[model samples]
Target: MIAAVSGGSKDPQAGGGDGREPITAAAVAAQVGGVLVGDGSIEVRGIAPLDRAGPNELSFLSHLRYGQWFATSRAGVVLISPELAELAGTPSTRIVVAKPVDAMVALLARFHRKEPRAQGVHSSAVIANDVRLGEGVTIDPFVVIGEGVVIGDGSWISAHAMIGAGSVLGRDVRVHSTAVVYPFTELGDRVTLHAGARVGREGFGFVPQANGVVRIPHAGRCILEHDVEVGANSCIDRGSVDDTIIGAGTKIDNLVQIAHNVRVGRGCFLASQAGVAGSTRIGDGVQIGGQVGIGGHVTIGAKANLAGGAGVIGNVPAGETWSGYPARAHRDHLRASAAIARLAKIVRPLEQLVSKPFSSSDGESRANSRADSRADSAPDESGT
Candidate 1:
């Protein structure tokens, strides 16, 4: 049921310059192993949200919250989860799957744009006499390969990238444009340093002295294990004494800062703008949300989750969810927040009472009125 949509160079195939073939609803269903329903003949050329999808585009519904946009969607083909299958929708073509988002991701991998492979070293690249390059390496223009550097097979050093002296890059490593790999750094296989990423940079360490501050020299290496990807503009500082290591399969988002001597474990995900101070140890499978700041020398247990904007100053237990400033257990943080809100309500009336100006006359009047009311309510000495 594969259909071909006629187009020029605008729609290139994944990993190739060939024009993308038009995909039909039936083809998508087959690719995701989804149960096809309604019209299998519908052609899907692009992907979009349910509300924004057109007749030539595909859409997905993974969560019930987004089901609000389902009925009115003009999408030609809809890939939906089983739970959302019962919901009525306008799209005539449907692909029912266990995970609609996963299905969509698979389709995106098939059609998404990929960087064109650049083979051979550019004439403008400066390679040191002792630098060793493996088979099928691509060194783009303005790239500088320092002495004693070893670039493994199929590695790509993008334009303006600088590999410092004695650095080692494994097979299929990608150093994007403007990325700087400092001296003696080790990047494992399939490691990707995005544009402007600074790896193995000297850490911020200084000893305060009476005369002046003495900068501590960093002599340790920065090591990124296999499949670790550092996002654009992220900075990974080299250690002062111990090696700074990022474990295999860790994905760091843009603008992240990993300070000196920090050890991040395998399969950890660090969101954008997250900063881990020096000497911190993060266990495997940890998830750090955006803008989270971790203090120095702290240890985060494996599988611990840090909520967005959390200020972590202490260790987090494994598998626990932490949030709020001076991060604590998620439940405790919520309870503390609720208590503060309740306390605020209690304090408001007292605040108002204390804020009012006091007058002697008003107090005396109130006292007299209370006395009169008591007298009226009091029983007479004689029988009434």
Candidate 2:
């Protein structure tokens, strides 16, 4: 929350911020700690882009790419960065800031509206006799709490969410609708499981026997550290023997898959559809792009980056960027791709030559030779 004006308009109400309060350009500038260069009394209601903002709306100029739109903008007030503040713009009021984007984000809370969460457990929720719930917990309708489950204060279990037996959720943890927490799983404080997320599920481990295959039972827990957010429909499998642990502040996109015994370090960002095979260790602050595939037992060092669609088969060094199938260094991948393109260009001419028949000159020469051969072979017309 950014510091703002002490008091002028009505306080923001629950579920709707500034609905009855009229925000002015001065108030906006004061809230974001920006310099006011124009009319401070102009009223603004909502935020929009420069091209789309009307006379009552506030707009922002953050990047040079959007500077072109500023000249003809009709916005009543604009938050402009110092670099673009002197640029030609038509707005009546300008609030100059070092970081316009940050200022805009701060102002967003004033206009953002969200539904109020109801307090206390619903009548239809099912809680076991031994379940321990902390203060300010809100359990939605049809949510199931298994025996020995413990949820800390301010935790919210959405409708139809299931907490398995012996699972423990720390303070302010949120389990969205239909999300499942398997038995003995642990979620640290401020962790969020989005709708339909599955945590602590059994891994796909099987041993091939002569007659058939035998499934290995998973006996380990899945643990998410503080501030970790699991996206909707993502699956994190419990370890076959050891725990599957996600470090603090890691964010996983939708449809991600994490196999058993995998350990992810802190502050990693994994895009949608990324899959990590079993027993892989990913270090801190790693950025994995969309649809990247990491092989089993692999090690990715801290601060490593994996590009989209990369297929990682081995270890990745720290602070490196890797891409392509059988992922290598980014520069190496680029070189290989460039070489392949150049080779294709070279092969194209040869392919065309091979596909063509005899050239015009060759055809003419062959025809002349055939004519001479026919003339020589023609029976001696002299009748000698």
Candidate 3:
């Protein structure tokens, strides 16, 4: 689901008109260094897709296949690539750019309205006595801040987020609605925790007891370096005694799970639903595919590529491609799979022979006859 401000003007050509000036198509062409074709005087109020755009809307043609609709579109202004300019016939106005899609994105961002929140703490928020908030911080309604928590400058805490005691958040960190940051967690600058993301949760560790299993105490914290992003519904568990660290510039997808003491290095891309067991160290620039499971205590070296649904049972060396369960080298796994296919062919004939019932003497005679037939089939020096 694409999360954005909801319940605003559904019309693409409308603006908030709150002292923010609207931009024109000619101004956009001049700023982006594009050529203006057709009518340069036509004005556009907002941006939208081709199908839903109205007379005041600004649309674009990126792919060549969609060029057919450009001539029939009622949009007041059209952003077109140089290759698509010929296909657009006498539109209201046209701005020719090298990349039409990128130009459209730039135009949409300039006109989008932001949801407004009061710049101070709301009456419904519950902040503990010992918590320290920096200047210009905004705490939305229903937000809870525990004791000894420190939130840096310009941080926005959405509704229903629970910031545990002693947790520290750096500047410009955005904690989405319903996200939980447990006790003693640390988040660096520009980190974004999507809605329902759980940080510093208890790791899955247990011990056998006389009556039942005893839950291990999680005494450590979770540390996320600068520019890290966690997707919605993902969980990162705290360590038993040491901090679980996710290095800078790592992007984790939705529903991912990182167990206790797992250290993920810088610039790693973890796809959706990927899981790493306890104490596993994943090296820098590693690409782990969706649903990949790495066993506990295993080390994955730098630049390793793990395919989707691959299960790692042992340590993987640097710069290797791995796939399949009990993951091996990709080439070796394919060779082993081919050998197994050939073995199945040989086993099927033997199974048919063994399944047939026969007398003991008949079986012995059949075995002797087969041996003689094999001897006769062999080449001899002279004909007997």
lDDT of each: 0.91, 0.91, 0.85
**Which numbered prediction scores highest in TM-score against the true structure?**
1
Q: Which residue segments of model 2 deviate by more than 4 Å?
A: 1-20, 352-384
Ranking of all predicted structures according to TM-score, beginning with the best and ending with the worst: 1, 2, 3
- lDDT digits (tens) for residues 1-384 of candidate 1: 112322344533222213367788898899999999989988777788888888878889988888779989998889998888879878878899999988888888655655665678888999999999999888888999899999999898999999999999999999999999999999999999999999999999999999999999998989999999999999999999999999999999999999999999999999999999999999999999999999999999999999999999999999999999989999999999999999998898999989999899989999999999999988898955
Among residues 3 or more apart in sequence or in different chains, the pairs in candidate 1 whose N, CA or C atoms overlap within 3 Å are 5-22
lDDT of 3 by residue, 1-384 (tens): 112333344443363222245567788788777898766666566676676666666788878777557657777778888887777453657888999888777766666666664577878899999899987788888999999999988788999999999999999888999999999999998899999999998999999999999999988889999989999999999999887999999999999999999999999999999999999999999999999999999999999999899999999999899988889988888898899899999998889899988899998999999999999899888865
Instruction: Write the number of the candidate with greater TM-score, choosing between 2 and 3.
Output: 2
Off by over 4 Å in 3: 1-21, 58-108, 303-308, 316-384
* Residue-level lDDT tens digits of model 2 in 1-384: 112212335344322234546688998889899999988998887777888888888889988888779989988899999888888878858999999988888888877654457778788999999999999888888999999999999898889999999999999999999999999999999999999999999999999999899999998889999999999999999999999999999999999999999999999999999999999999999999999999999999999999999999999999999999989999999999999989998898989988888789998999999999998877775864
Cα deviation of 114 in candidate 1 (Å)?
A: 1.6
Locate the minimum summed-lDDT window of 10 residues in model 2.
Answer: 1-10
Worst 10 contiguous positions by lDDT, candidate 1: 1-10
TM-score of each: 0.87, 0.85, 0.75
Per-candidate clashes, comma-separated: 1, 0, 0
